[model samples]
Target: MKYSIIISFLLLTVCLTAFGQEKQSRKSKNPNSAAAEKGLIKVSVMYPFAEGKTFNMEYYETKHMPMVAGFLGSNLVKYTIEKGLASGIPNQPLPYMAVGTFYVKSLDEYQAAIAPNRDAIRADFANYTNVAPVILVSEVVR
Candidate 1:
């Protein structure tokens, strides 16, 4: 009888603790709630290399990206550049030479920043790859 009571008490305590933690988590606000509410925007640029095309990784890394950073400044929350290695299929060439993802607080902020520097950014493309980049802008839902 005593062992049964003790086990029951322990189980009750554990349940209560778990309940409390769950309640707290639900009450707590997400750190990115404000950004989520406003909606986060991601800009992706894909450069696909084909026959006779070229990619200047050195110039892109050293000059183009730095210029982009300078132009975006604080508005650019974060950005990533990925060099394509190989396709999922063995012995297959990568479809894209490079991909760039830019995270911003909002579409408006991105537009504002890019609007002023669009010409300069476009011009810098000639210094890098000959392939025309495919650009996509998407909202981050999760």
Candidate 2:
């Protein structure tokens, strides 16, 4: 049940994001430009939604993410934090309350850099959210 909800949320999010991205990507004429795809690795941390869960968006955005990005240093290409708004089922709660993702040039580099800071990152979770986060790592094929 849990995994299904997460999967559903992920599918919905990807479909929406990819729709807009397809049009924008077609306009990029430079093959060797800095924005060109380099097969980036994506690391996403998702917070599942529950009836009584709590999430402090302000602290997460203003402090936690900045601190993490600094710890990642140059290995972190970019990051995004998304807040859930609606679900496929009318009046149903979204599967995830929040999702944070970071893009890295290499998966190995990301693993090495995050190893030392893992404890610190985990410790900071209490400051913003009561729900435990689920991590998903994948290669950006396109």
Please give, for residues 1-142, the per-residue lDDT of candidate 2 as tens digits: 8988888778878877887787568656554644454588889999999999999999999999999988888988899999988775544679999999998888888888889999999999999999999999998775
lDDT of 1 by residue, 74-129 (tens): 87877888888866444457789888888787678778888989999999899888
Error of 1 at 99 (Å): 0.8
User: What ranges in model 1 sit over 4 Å off?
Assistant: 1-39
Candidate 2: stretches off by over 4 Å: 1-35
| Error of model 1, residue 136, in angstroms | 0.8
- Which pairs of residues clash in candidate 1, taking residues 3 or more apart in a chain or in different chains? none
The TM-score, computed over Cα atoms with residue i paired to residue i, of candidate 2 is 0.75
**Candidate 1 residue-wise lDDT at 88:** 44
Instruction: Give the number of the best model, judged by lDDT.
Output: 2
